[model samples]
Target chain A: MLCVVNTSAEELRRIALQHFARIGFAGASLNAIAEEAGLSKSSVLYHYSSKEALLAAAVEPAVDRLAEVIEGFTRTGRGAMDDEFVQRFVDLLLSHRLEVHVFINQGQSLADIPAIQRANALIQRLGDAVTDHIPTVRDRIRFGVALGGAAYVLVAAAQWSSEPLDDLDETRAALVDTITTLLADLPVSSAATA
Target chain B: MLCVVNTSAEELRRIALQHFARIGFAGASLNAIAEEAGLSKSSVLYHYSSKEALLAAAVEPAVDRLAEVIEGFTRTGRGAMDDEFVQRFVDLLLSHRLEVHVFINQGQSLADIPAIQRANALIQRLGDAVTDHIPTVRDRIRFGVALGGAAYVLVAAAQWSSEPLDDLDETRAALVDTITTLLADLPVSSAATA
Candidate 1:
């Protein structure tokens, strides 16, 4: 019985995440999500008390993972410029493509929701972690472009591609390479040759 | 007399763009836009028959500018990898930061709106122009990251920053440099050193 309830809840979250990513959270309907999951609206509510609750459930794991990543950065005194951190960040993004899509694009409009607010705060902290060690606004914006850009590219790729990305390994390698290039601190003369 | 009408219309668009960028089109209210612009709701309607029309007016110039950029690419055979094209693209994004923000983050949710649909189509054309010459999926995703990432970073910077970005010249130079690096097709060995 516990297994049955857990499976249903998981199924509902999958459907809900898709809806939230496709349409903004405000535009998604609880009824449509329940119907898609082959359950009554009341049954959907039985598992998650409200639409906000459902959104929280659907996105929290990704949010928590990001939080953990930030915690790791803080603990180790490592930042986004670190190659291992970049790799881990890219992996996290690819794994949670839909949740990141919802958070990046739709999270702003839904900031009144406590879940989204928390996610936004986490993103700010992540930004701080990335930029705190860097001095110039130029370098700061580079980190922003590299990290934010990686998230944007992954989400856009997932959203716009008709078929799933054919090669995840290739995508990951290309992303890491591009981000490393973006974040590298090279002298202007060397950059020209580079 | 013509200038007076034009000034009011421009003012309304300015206010509408901010609202759309900040809260998104679905969450933004026409009434609030009118009030902010110090005009009556009827006057706002007189200029733009519907909320969609207002959105169209607000974003069309930026969309048109991007379309021109893509057309230049097609006409000149200068894809996103070209240095001049990168500079021009970065300039357009910085000048119209808020419009890009609305188009990127909220455009997906408001696809039913004709204006957003047009903007989204332009972005697809821009993508095609960037990647048509590049053979690999990896290169394609690289272009997506560089271009989309630049736009996302700029918008996020604008949205999240408490004060306006202090130096446009530095921002533009850094963006052009970062994008050039992202799009550069360096050999694997040189890339390691670069």
Candidate 2:
């Protein structure tokens, strides 16, 4: 029903992300990736020339998904700002904080690798997209800070596993509520909300 | 003159931490440490017999400083539960963010080594001390989240050498304000008035 690249390329990317996340980039070898994907080594090489290339491709879905979520929040022409979408985004990040840890932790220097550097743009765009939708300077600041703060707390909890952060989730919810209230109060247009 | 630690053991510890931070624990060479410290290889050996011993000593100061800071805040007793102390603690971390980064960055795994791992208990004691000072659950929760968020951001910012966080001091202040506001509202007794 779909194109060939759509199916196999997507499948390979998924497999590669899973394996690299668990074992780390250096620990992840071509053979291991191939085995994880149930493919021959040669087949992987056919798709991506090097480990760097494979790693770059693997993060694409995550980048795209985040971009979509952020962009959906900021789509002012079509919709005012969707609190539900924002909540889901925050929830996704909190519940699967490990995915983010695996993404950033494995090596922040991945930006030096030519193909892998694109995620930087994706991250910036996500921030910009959300920041753009908010009308008031205070609201914009609140939105960015809340998002960043929540994300950071989740990572800290993961890193300081022994330290309890049951309260952090409550703080996170309160932060989101604050942002939502700020957005709702903004004197945007009727059509955008309607 | 100040009573500096003249013992061979203390001197070696001081010198090794400098080298380990500049290079990394794995990357630091024992011979180079001896050269910089103005001690012969034999003397360095007399103080710390192995490279691992030297490296463990190297990461200790930053971690020790962190414990010290945590302890200082905790020792303030019920005063630390106040918004002003929380704000000051946040300020302290931001001002010294760079030193914290050097200790935590690659040096975190130093905790795996038996000698340095004991230092983790000191750090945990500090965290425990934080809760012991708080009078209520809500203030305790607020303290944890704010401190956690501030620590995470300030450390990561050290990686970006070009950022003008050097001038505005915005990053640290922003974190403190976030924590202060969250705590102020969450608890009945405590108020974080920025």
Candidate 3:
């Protein structure tokens, strides 16, 4: 019974992504989504209930996939995640830039929504995965900072860059290099007094 | 004439900060601010006009202070920014946690406001202050990433920490270490090719 509903929801999610990308979260109304999907307004409402709900449905899969990737790192028993892993994570963020854009733009006001809360939890989990390997509190904080920094760049690269980012591959490589350097340098243990 | 206006405006901005910190940017109302400040609604409107306008007044001083700090770095002609400067920066950010929270939480959506736009431009300039000595594009990107990461942690620390962040000093040290590592690890020209 749920499988039948899942199919339609999946279809709606795909359509929602396109509408969101083109018109943004604010501009993409349920009526527009329904019109674009060739579905009745009531049908769309039945599945999504609201615009925020629709956005959550559209963004959840990507968040789930990201969680799985971070989970893999946690299970691997590595002391630190490599640049390749960081690069892969950046790629995921870049691929879902539209959704990321909306989630970030919504900020603290909409954080009470279940989907956004879950996504925030997942992000915390990802941050934990990167920092868990470091034994010292100081290094852990530093790792957290580096991770936060790399993620910020990936999420807001388009806005931060002076020139338009023409080559994403090069951008990815540069970001990986930055994260790699941050992870490689370990502070002296005695100096980490806190 | 402007002197008398500035005094009352300053008082209103101070009252607004307390309201904004307690209730958040979205939750803070102009009426609430006026009531809290012992001013009439019309008086508050005469001074600030809108909530965003009130926010602009409140956040501008902190931005100006930060700009001064960054300007010092730019004039120093140092190869790399020292830990003291970074610590001062971290302290400035931590002290203005409420304003930082509002600015970051607004994200890309409110960036078009003249105050927010000026703030963003100032942040870009700060990134430049640290990286201007470095010639390569990869190093510059890495520098930007570290700066963004440090800034994000500073802004979001209150929310992101699982427990209330009891020790800000430790957090500041850790962030400084992360940024220092990023600056120190400038790529060899050959290694920077991406």
On residues A40-69, what C-alpha lDDT tens digit does candidate 2 reach at each position?
999888888888788777765565666666
lDDT score, residue A163, model 3? 56
Question: TM-score of each model's B chain?
Answer: 0.86, 0.55, 0.66
DockQ of each: 0.51, 0.17, 0.35
Residues A93-184, model 3: lDDT tens digits: 66776566445434344577776677677767765654555667677767666666766665555555555357777777776667666666
lDDT, candidate 3, B1-194, per-residue tens? 85756777888998897666444565567787888778888999898878788888888877777777677666665632666566676677667766764555453445767776776777777656545567766777787776667767755555566563577677767766676667656642222212
Q: What is the lDDT of residue A92 in candidate 2?
A: 61
Q: Could you give candidate 1's per-residue lDDT for residues A1-194 as a string of tens digits?
A: 84745999999999999988766676578899999999999999999999999999999999888887777766676433466767788889989988987888766677888777888998887677656666677777777787788888877766555665678899899888777776667221122113
What lDDT does candidate 2 reach at residue A59? Answer: 66
- Clash pairs of candidate 1? none
Task: State residue A32's C-alpha deviation in candidate 3, in Å.
Answer: 12
Q: After superposition, which runs of candidate 3 have C-alpha atoms over 4 Å from their true positions? A: A1-48, A78-80, A101-111, A127-135, A162-164, A185-194, B1-47, B77-80, B104-108, B127-133, B162-164, B187-194
Docking class of 3: acceptable
Kindly report, for each predicted structure in the order presented, the TM-score of its chain A compared with the true chain A: 0.87, 0.53, 0.63
Which run of 10 residues does model 2 chain A get worst, by summed lDDT?
A: A185-194
TM-score winner, 1 or 2:
1
Interface root mean square deviation of every model, in Å?
2.0, 5.9, 4.7
Q: Please give the fraction of native interface contacts (Cα pairs under 8 Å between A and B) kept by each candidate.
A: 0.51, 0.07, 0.50
Error of 1 at B142 (Å): 1.9
Candidate 2 lDDT tens digits, B22-131: 44565456777788778788888776768876765655555565666567656765455566666666766665554444334332445567545655565566556655
